[model samples]
Each structure stands twice: as structure tokens, then as C-alpha cells.
Target chain A: MSARPRDPMLPRSYRIESVESELPGGEVFSWTLRPRGGELEVGQPGQFNMLYQLGIGEVPISISALGEDGTLIHTIRDVGGVTRNMAALSAGEEIGVRGPFGTAWPVAAAEGHDVLLVAGGIGLAPLRPVIHHVLANRERYRRIFLLYGTRQPADILFRKELERWRGRFDIDVAVTVDRADASWRGDVGVVTRLIERGGFDPRNSIAMVCGPEVMMRFAVMSLERRGVPARQIYLSMERNMQCAVGYCGHCQYGGHFICKDGPVFPYDRLEPLFDVREL
Target chain B: MDDLAQVFAEEPFFSGFSDAQLRRLAGLARPEVYQNGRYLIRQNGSADRFMLITTGHVVLKAFVPQRGMVPLETLGPGDPLGWSWLAPPYKWHYDGRALERTEVIAFEAEGLRQAMEQDHELGYRLQKRMIEVIAHRLQAARLQSLDLYGNPAGDLP
Candidate 1:
């Protein structure tokens, strides 16, 4: 028998309101979406959507930000078959949408604590919404620190936004590049080094990190070294997610389904499962 | 107090050094500057001097067969430049190039070595700090060589 009508498993149509190339290379882009109906709604900071191109494939991308005007932002890197199709399309094109699925960054619980957002490369996409939320409710958090690391000056994303955030009195942002050329004046090293430069009250700090698993591992280690407990750190994990609703085991790790249970999890919960290498 | 000693007294690399110790070390140091594109030290060159950078930055680089002058690490103001002088052979392992208009407090390796030999206390503190810097750079190289971003598992490009 077929599944019931209006099934959560079924995809909904959403129009690509606009798309901006994220870098000069044109491999990555930030797409703004407007849903055709109430079928799929923008979810939480760390939640994701399964974007389906009619003739191609469907892939998961995090909701980078929920625009004040009600549009959803997705920063996608052109990778496998599906994303390539989505990136080549122009405005006014319709793409399939399903969810703002999975758990979100613990912004609510992080209130009243010093917030540290550590992101690497495209990892910044999933954490951008958290940054917007904290700024909107600036009075709730004690202090906000953002430490972002990318490959080089050429790979930096949202350049203007980073400059704006860097100018804010309340937000402390540190950026590092893996390598630097003649014109690059910023710190040239790993992002973890910024944890030491960032002045956060570790006892009252809650760190949210989104990056390559390798980078996040070191990030958590550095946070722990700085006296922030493991439970106080959260990271967003990326895996091959097919079903947004956890039915397919494509995104399973250590008996936990990344689709339903989390894309964000406390460092303590992920510690043993992380570094498992393709598990 | 000498201006160089005053600066050294406040730097992290020279932390734990008493004002008296800073003054003693500063005597063997001279001010030096390098323009952009100049090499502070070349690989295999005799490490006659070690430096404490005061302004601008220098990059540690190595020349691979196929890659020309690949940058390994960058050292900014308040960072130390050469550790090869502290070890035997006393030859640099990489090229240090000025990334900008760099100002440095250069210490004669022979003079500092003699001073350390005479003052065990000063030698112990300075040696420990140099070891830490060396260890840090070694770890950075290891991490960078991993190429964490190039093939990050599950990360989309």
C-alpha cells in the first residue's frame, strides 16, 4: 500500500527567490528560497532541508538563515550531482523542498552564557542563523565570540558580513587562514589558535562549533583546555542524509539518527562517536 | 631601562623573566629591520642570530622541488623568529622572509650562548620557553600537513 497523503516524506515545491555566487570560483552559492505553500517551513538554526531538483537528485542543505522578510537562505557548495544542478539554475526556478529538519543549535539554553561560535569553511552556513538570533537578542547573552577558519583569503565567504560583525562592539570575531599570500594580513594558522585569543569567561561560556569533523575535534579539545566543560560545547555533524525523517539509515552513527536526533549534539555525546571514521 | 628590554619584558615569549634578566638579555640584542621580499634567514645558513619580532610579520617557508617557496607558518609581531641557534649545527631549517616592513630585536647567538652558560637560572628559563615555541611550530606543521580541509570526510567541498 502507498503512504498516506501529504506525507512528511514527500517533497514540496519552493521557488529560488535569488542566488548569489559565494566565491569568485562560482562553485558555491547562497540561494534564497520562498516556499509555494505551507508545505515546508523554515526551521531552527541547525536544521536542514532536502533540496530536490526535478530531473536531478535531492541533497540536504542547512537553513543558513531565516531572513526577517521570511525567505530561507541556503549556502550550498556545488558538490555531487544534485547540488550541481541546483547551482546552475537561475532565479524564479522551482526546486523541491522538505523540512527544516533535525535538532537546532541550543541558542535558548545558551542565553545568559558567553557564546562562542567556531566555524570552518562552509561550516559557517549552518551557524549563520545562530549568529543572527544572538544579535537579535543581544541582551540575553553575556558575550559573543566568533572564530572562523578557512583555507585562504580566496576561500573566505560572506566577506562583507564578516567585516560588519568584526566592527561590532559586542561581538568578538577572529579569523584565521590555513595559508596566506602576500596580500593576506590575517593570522595564518588553524582556527583553534583563536580560542586562546578570544576572551570568553570559560565558566560561563557555551561554544557552538560547525566545521570539518577534524577541525571540530580540535576545537572541542581547545575549548576543554580553556576550562569549558565538554557538555557546554556543541557541534553540527554532516553526513549523507536521505530521508529528513530518520526512516532511512543513511545518516546513522552510533545508534543515533542524524536526521531526526541531531545535526547538533553536545560535545560529550559526540566525543566517543566522533573520530570513528566512516561509521 | 633599554627600549628593547622594555618591549621584551612585556612579551609572552620573555614572560617570567625578571626586569633584571630582560636587561641582561637585551644587552646582546640589536635592532634590525627587513623590507618586504627580503629573506631574514635562508635554509642551511648559519644561525648566527635569533630574533624577537617587534613590528610587522615574517613567514617561515620551505622550497619543495615542484613548489617554489611554499609558506609553512607565519610569525607576527611579538613572535620569535629563529630556534635553530639554540640547537647544535646552528643552521636554519627553513627560509624566513619579511611579509611586511618588519622590525626585530636580533640577538647574537654566540653572545647569548656565553651569557646563558654563565647564568644557569636565565638559561633554564629561556631554554624552556624556546622548547615550547619549537613544540608549537612542530604541531602546527603536523596539522597543516594533514590537509584537513582538502578531503574532509562528509564535508561538502
Candidate 2:
């Protein structure tokens, strides 16, 4: 670590190596940055990048996947103008990138404890890194559980990978859908219901939850009720983040700047402000 | 066969009940097996019994005017299904169907009702559990209606 502040504000040119459509409106972009003429820095999982769409605007998107050969993956859902444009991007196109900013999941802290990673819908994107990290070093952690809930079967991201992970004996993967058609023979309900049958030792467990605010609130409540300490539970928050640094006031939460301070914070620190509604 | 008392003790719905109370509950339950596609309970049907599933899967669904049967939840072992038996008029709100061959213990509503009436203490305990179930379901239904994941927009609570 140098105090050099490497490429803080300058935009790097990342060539989109591949683009894959997920579900109906979602897409995943794989990029290999050639900043001036070199490789882009490897970003830690749970971190985000400021992606610039030239004339449109820049949006902070989380690092969804990391390639073994050093590529950055971003999963985008077409919600607004920037995201819609991101979805329309084709392979070989180049996008401007600012950084892999903000804090990351507490992977080290979760070691030795049962790791429960819970995600809902597109919320799974951010937590994908944690999944990769845990699986890569499976021996360090205790039981690794992933409880994911999506809107429906078609809406599930990383479908092939989820199936692969589910097949593993060392990991516990429980997926539920909000609604199911006749074809879906899997579990159906809110994700929290899975916790009742999840069988994790709450006292020695660390839970990471990411999803809609309402969904996250309920997940946190369930974990808390099961005797998991508020300190050990973590939540990846959703907010309007601009600048991806502390310079702009766009993503301020009470006193914290989500861009620099956190997108991942312990439930104990955020308990007071978790769902204040007016905040 | 799964021991009845042990099975009853494991359900979260009956987690804190005393062993004596749990034994009485186990005694009241009648074991039944259902094949796939069987309707354990139907909407608007008389809810004369509630079921505690020990093995296999059951789906809770509601039929909309145009949407046929909309699956709400697929419950598995250790789940308590149908609280409508405790409420007035006693009609099932949703259809409970076995998606696969299933094993469950059906608790007779009339017998339990009579037992409760005879023993006010038992009635109070059972009523407390039913109220908890109703409140929990109300909260779940409210969350479902929010449809938070269906149409997601960023930058808002």
C-alpha cells in the first residue's frame, strides 16, 4: 500500500470481453481493462466501481464476479437510463471505469463460524464474491450456507453456478421463490422461512444479507430472533451513491458516506438506522 | 417411524411447550399419509383439522379469478399447516396440496376443541399458539403484497 492514491479520479478504458443476457432484462458484462496499456487492478469482492457511460452519466455498480484470469464482471438490471444502456452494450465495446471502491464483506471475521450468505433477486450479485471466496478456501470456514430468494425461477441469476454449488456436500444452498408456476417443484416462500430449516448454529454464525430494504429488514429480524448477535450479522445497503468517494454528498446515511465508509456494515452499527423510514 | 413426542417437540410452533403438554398433543395427533396431487385442505372447505408435516412437501396456494392456482408456499418437514381450524366459521383460506407423497399428523379439531373446553388451561395455551401463527402469517402476507422484488427501482427504501 502506497499513499500514491492510484488512479483515483482518472477513468480507465475497459474493453467488454463478453456480454451475456440473464433473465429477460438482466445482463452480465465481462471486462478486461487496458488503462493506458495495462491490466486493471483486481478488486476485492463486495467492492464497487464507478462505471461511466461516456455522455450519459456514471453509476456505481458492485463487483459481481471475478474471473480466474483477471476480469471484472458486472451484473446489471435495466432499471433506468444508465442501466438500460449498460444492458444494451455489446462485446468489444469499451466503458470507462473509476474504481473498486468502498468496504468489502468481512470474510476473515466469518472464518471458523458458520457462514450464512442470504440474497434476494439481483441482490445476489454483490454477494457472489463472498461465495467465491468461501468456496475457494472452504477449509477455513465452518458450514457455508447460501439462502437465496428470487421472484421466480426465470429471475434467478447464476443459474448454472447455483446448481453446481447446490451439488456440493460441503455447502448448504437453499433457494426459494416468491411465486412458482407448475414447473417449479422447489421451495417457495420468503427467504426467511428457509432459516427455520437451515439448521445453522446461531451462536457461532455470521450472516450476510443483501436484498430489498423490506426483505433485508425481515431477514435481520429472523437472524436476531435466532440468537445470532447483532454484531455478527452484516447487511449490504442500497442507496443513491455518486462519486464512489466521500467527495459527493449523494450517498450520505446520517453521518456515514456509503461510498467510502460502507455498503457493508455490521447490523449492530446500523441497527438504529436500519429501517427508520424517514431517514 | 419418527417418534411423535420428539417430532412435536421439534416444531417451532410447539418449541417451548412443556413435555407434558407436548405428549398430550402427540396423543391427539392421527398419522396419515397422502399421495402426490392430494388436496389436504381446500379453499372454502370446512377446516376441521390442521396438519403437522413430518415428511414430504405440501404447497399452499390460492386461486385467483383468472390466475388459476397461485402457489404461495411449499412447506416441508417440521412445518405446521393450516391455522384456519382455530378461527370462526372454520374454512380454509388457501388450498393445501401434497406435491409429493407426504407423511403428516392430522390433529382433530373437534376433539381438540372439546379437550380445550374441558381444560381451560389447555385451551389458553393452544389459543396462544394459534394467535402467534395468525400474526406471523399476517406479517408474511403483508411482505408478499409489497412485491419488493417484482419491480425493483434503485435509490429508495
| Candidate models: Cα lDDT each | 0.85, 0.83
lDDT of 1 by residue, A1-279 (tens): 985656667788889999999889777799898888763475999999888889788888998889777688899988766777777899999998878789999999999999999999899889999999999999999999989988878888888999999998999887888886645656778888778554689989999999888788888877887799999999898788988788999889898899888989998998888778768
* Steric clashes per prediction: 0, 0
> For candidate 2, lDDT tens digit of each residue in B31-135?
899999999999999989878888899999898877788898888887778888877898999998998999998998877788778878778888898787667
- Please state the error at residue A116 of candidate 2 in Å: 1.0
Clashing pairs for predicted structure model 2, backbone only = none
Interface RMSD of each: 3.5, 2.9
Candidate 1, residues B44-132, lDDT tens digits: the string is 99999999988887888777786566666777777789988988999999999887899988999998998899999999998998987
Residue A232 of model 2, lDDT score = 91
Candidate 1 clash pair list: none
Q: Mark the 10 consecutive residues where model 1 chain A has the least summed lDDT.
A: A179-188
Instruction: State candidate 2's TM-score.
Output: 0.93
Instruction: For each candidate, give its TM-score against the true structure.
Output: 0.82, 0.93
Question: Chain B TM-score, candidate 2?
Answer: 0.83
